[model samples]
Target: MDSMASAPGKAILFGEHAVVYDKPAIALAINKRATITIKESHKDYTSIKSDNIGLEAIISPETGLKLKKGEIGILNYILKALEFYHDSKPIKIKLEIEIPIGAGLGSSAAVTVATIAALDKYHKRKTTLPSIAKRAHKVELEVQGAASPLDTSISTHGGLIYLNEEKKIDQIKGDLKDSLVIGYTQSEDTAKMVKLVKERMERHPTIINHIMDAIAHTTKKAKKALETNDKECLGELMNINQGLLDAIGVNTRSLSDMIYTSREAGALGSKITGAGGGGSIIAYSPNRTRKIIETLKRKGYNAMKADPSKKGVIIEH
Candidate 1:
């Protein structure tokens, strides 16, 4: 039997580093997704292949997972998910990832969620979505050392999600898909970026705490703007949120250039989407998406129009 599952990537619109401090955040599920297909193998060991990251590995209960030097981190996510299952039965795993790896777009979370969901189907476990999400979060935490449930939650549930300081999740209903634009420069280490912010906070707790509070407030206002379909207000809130992220020391020179270029091209608001050392940025360009994308492309960036996916992880057997 063959079991396949896919989950959407995410873009954090409101909070990134602040969310780690238990502040509110707003994230949306992007159409890009990571898919995993599992099948029983005749051999005595599990084989993994991922074309997106140029990875191929073979693992057994005894030999364990071994990778080449400088292998991408998705393999770690796969290994952790496999460990959760403990199904040593020889299997072949194929990963097809559309989200750029390490671009702060929840690529790791997406792949981990899809892998677990597919494994569940393959083993006839019939795991529920919530269980899969929880399990995926564990896998991420094990691999990344530190993580927030925001990415896994959004990838599992899809659409728009609001994560409050209390860790409560509220699904926001809105269709700002047409107004969303994403631009990618390069990938960054999420863990490193998170650590950098932590160091800064340790050095200046009061200042960073105030910044976190401001981000929480901005996130709440952005939620309202989405609920009422106030594009202008939401755009302004995004700019404010970006300033807070900058204050936290996640912004980069390339990211800032892309953001300002987008704004100059008529984006209502633009900011780094996640971790932000050198990842991607999101621009709120309601009617000027084309112009913003063109401008970013001319300035040398991989730009695209993105939509918030309503569907989450699903079996495709």
Candidate 2:
């Protein structure tokens, strides 16, 4: 018998860095997802392979080589747990992440969650969203030294979420009035951007504080707009966040131009999604989403319009 689990990738719609400092953040699980599969076998050792990212590994219970690594290091936490179960029965596992990597989307976290969940089911383990969150939060540290809980939380929970400073997750159910156009800038370097931000934080403490303060204020309005179903206010808040990112020196010329172009084409508002410095931009405007995509396409930018994902982790045999 084989067990499988899948999870949707995510993006920080708002409040990326502030969440780390105890501020509210919002995230959504997009349509793209990854899957993890496990099968029971009689081999002397269990093997893990991921054809997507060139990862492969083997684990043996007899030799005490149980640490999860190589092709699927995201399952390290699950492997540690497996040591306690002592399955003894050798197994084979295969992991695959179909989500576009380094798109400022939470591809890695989604795959990590899927892997843990798959293993949990294979062991008949009870895996709650909170448990999955805790596990994936730690796994994210391996991929991104320090990632806000927003990604894992949303990916695991499978909905639009409001994460408060208290680590309390509140799922906000509302008609996301506008669609978003995702413009792929094709440049991704989270590590470099993190280092840049840290250096800036250490050198310009005051600037960082001011930006975070503005972000907090804008985020409040953004959430309020959502609660009130006010699209205009939400768009304005997105614009505010973009400006704040500019102040932090993470926004690139290409991203800014795309945002400007999208805005000009018809987007109500736009901003760089993740760590900035070249990733993807989200522009909210249901009416103009198509126009924005067409405009960007004509300009040679690979932009596509997408909506929040309705489901997470669809498994196929």
Candidate 3:
């Protein structure tokens, strides 16, 4: 028997770096997702394969996890997730990922969440959503060194998620109504960007602390806007959040151009969606979504529409 699961990726709307400091952040699960399929292995040791990263390897208690040269570390999320299950039976794991890697779209979280869900179902553990979320967060913390619960929580619960300073996860009552447009450049190192912000915060604690406070306030306002379906207010708040992200030195030339160009093309508000060194930017354009996408394409950007996903991790059998 094969147990398969899929989890949606996420886009941070109002907060990113500030959330690491226990500030509030808002995120929504996107349609893009990562799917994992698990089956009992005939071989003695467990094996993992992912065409997305073009790698395959064996994982076992005796040998431990090993990565070949030139392979990325995103697989660490999978390895860490496997550690929690404690299943003696070896399994063959396969990954099918739609979300772009290292683009700050919560790819790691999606993969981790899906992997855990699949394993739980395969082992007949029947883990609850909160339990799955907690385990996934642990995997992220182990792999990333520093990670907020926002991504893992959103990936586990789906819909619009509000993560508070207390690390509480809430599903906001509202919908994006297909107003979101994503423009992505090259992949960015989320950990590196996060460390950069940390360094800046250490050098100027007072100033950076104020900026975090402002981002938290903006995230709160954006939450209300989402509940009330106030697209205009949400857009404005997003712009404010973008400026704060820039102040933290996460902005890049290409990301800035994409944002400004989207705004000029009639985006109500446009800003970086994640750690923001070279990942992706989101534009809230509502009826003008197509126009913004076309305009962004003309400027040599990869742009697309991503609707908010209401479903989280699920067993597919």
**Whole-model Cα lDDT of every candidate shown, in order:** 0.88, 0.76, 0.88
Tell me the tens digit of each residue's lDDT in model 1 across 73-191.
78889888988874678899999999988778999999999999998888888788789889998998888778899999999999899998888888997768678889997767888
- Candidate 3 weakest ten by summed lDDT: 64-73
How well does model 1 score by local distance difference test?
A: 0.88
Higher-scoring candidate on TM-score, 1 or 2 = 1
Which RMSD does model 1 reach against the true structure?
1.4
How much is 257 displaced in model 3, in angstroms? 0.8
TM-score of each: 0.97, 0.85, 0.95
Better of 2 and 3 by TM-score: 3
Candidate 1 worst ten-residue window by lDDT? 64-73
Better of 1 and 2 by lDDT: 1
- In model 2, which runs have C-alpha deviations exceeding 4 angstroms? 41-46, 50-90, 312-317
Worst 10 residues of 2 by lDDT: 77-86
State the lDDT at 3 in candidate 2: 85
State in Å the error of residue 155, model 1.
0.5
Which ranges in model 3 have alpha carbons more than 4 Å from their true place? 60-70
